[model samples]
Target: MRPEKIAEANEIDARVAGALYMILADYNGMDMPTTNELKKSLRENGASFNVVKNRMLNRALSEDASALLKGQTAMIYGDGDVVEVAKVIKKFTAAKKKPVIKGGFVEGKSISAEDVVELSKLPSKDVLRAMLLGTLQAPCSQLVGVMNQKVASLVYVLSAVIDKKEQEA
Candidate 1:
């Protein structure tokens, strides 16, 4: 390989290694402004987008990941939330109808394009964590309420007994 090609491949490799997840797509018909818009959105979501040659991608990515590489491939990758990145891509696709999803690897496992869409549909990490916390807290809260109710009932019974004794006296 030429020196420039080697450098490019190294760069791709570095990006892949650094990212927690990557999504591949066919960005064939996307114009410059549209691509720029997508890039901007992805950047805001903590991902970077790049158009890479299939051969270079193949050289950089693993065997399973390389299988998705064919024809006008662009890679979107980030160290941030994978779901957020997928949401950005899905939103862009819904609006522009270009850069169709191919497939990608997340945390070293290859996933289908449909999986990427499903991921986009999911709540973000913080949301999921909050849901889990709520679920866990519900039972504890209920238990506390039940205990408090028993104590209140006891207090009411004692008060009623005191009133009856005073009336009898």
Candidate 2:
């Protein structure tokens, strides 16, 4: 390859690294076609995927490369929100009898394949938010009931006292 093309490829590698950083943190390398299909599946779900040379990617990340995804060199790439990428990977991979989520990294932290699957199992943000709201409302509902009961008891007690006083008068 020409020097300029090599440089361009390196630039592409860096981009792939950044994209992969947000996607697969580490991987258990798959066949070329499988990787391609993973990319296609992700793309259909609104995430883009890429396969990049290891050396170029390592150079691109400098010192922050995650060990899970680093060394020997090679990577699968995906892009979009990290959670979305994770969701896509988990969904397609789960559809198969055997899934390939090797393990991966995000920012600088290494993550495991099991971790990825676990993350996929998490309820969506909206669902979590709703659950929190329900929890918050539960306490408020209990408080409302307590206040109503206290007020009712106070009214009943005062009414009894007045009736007793009227009888004595």
Candidate 3:
């Protein structure tokens, strides 16, 4: 490889290494303006959209990831929320009807295109955390209510006994 090619591969490798997740998509038939808009949207959502040479990308990726690269591939990757990134891509694909999803890598595993769509359908991290919080608090809240009910029952019994004694007297 030429020195410039080697540098490009190294840069791609560094990007891949740092990413928490990556989505590969077909960028065929996308105009420059449309592609720039997609890149901007992804950037705002804390991900990057890069149209790299497939050969260079292959050099950077693991063997499993390399298999997904073919014909005008662009990589979307970030260290932030994977679901959010996937959502952005899904939205863009729906709006423009370009850049069809290929496949992805999440954590350390390669996933199918369907898996990428499924990931986009998932709730954001904040929403998922809120759901988990609600689940945890449910039991505690119920326990508190049950304890309060027992105390109230005891108090009611005590009050009734006092009234009965007073009426008898």
Ranking by lDDT: 1, 3, 2
Question: How many Å off is the CA of 50 in candidate 2?
Answer: 1.4
Candidate 2, RMSD to the unseen true structure? 5.2
lDDT of 2: 0.63
Error of 1 at 42 (Å): 0.7
Residue 84 displacement in candidate 1 (angstroms):
1.7
Instruction: Give the range where candidate 1 is weakest over 10 consecutive residues by summed lDDT.
Output: 58-67
- Model 3's alpha-carbon lDDT is 0.89
Please give the distance, in angstroms, between residue 22's alpha carbon in candidate 1 and its true position after superposition. 0.4
Tell me the deviation in Å of residue 45 in model 3: 1.6
Q: Write the per-residue lDDT of candidate 3 for residues 111-141, one digit (tens) a residue.
A: 8999988998999999999999999999999
Selected candidate, larger lDDT, 1 vs 2: 1
Which candidate has the highest TM-score of all?
Answer: 1
| Tens digit of per-residue lDDT, candidate 1, span 1-114 | 899988998999999999899889999999999999999999998999999999888878776555688789999999999999998888889999988999998999888999
Superposed model 2: Cα runs more than 4 Å off: 1-21, 25-46, 62-84, 96-99, 152-169
In candidate 2, which residue pairs clash? 25-104, 25-105, 26-103, 26-104, 26-105, 54-73, 54-74
lDDT of 1 at 128: 98
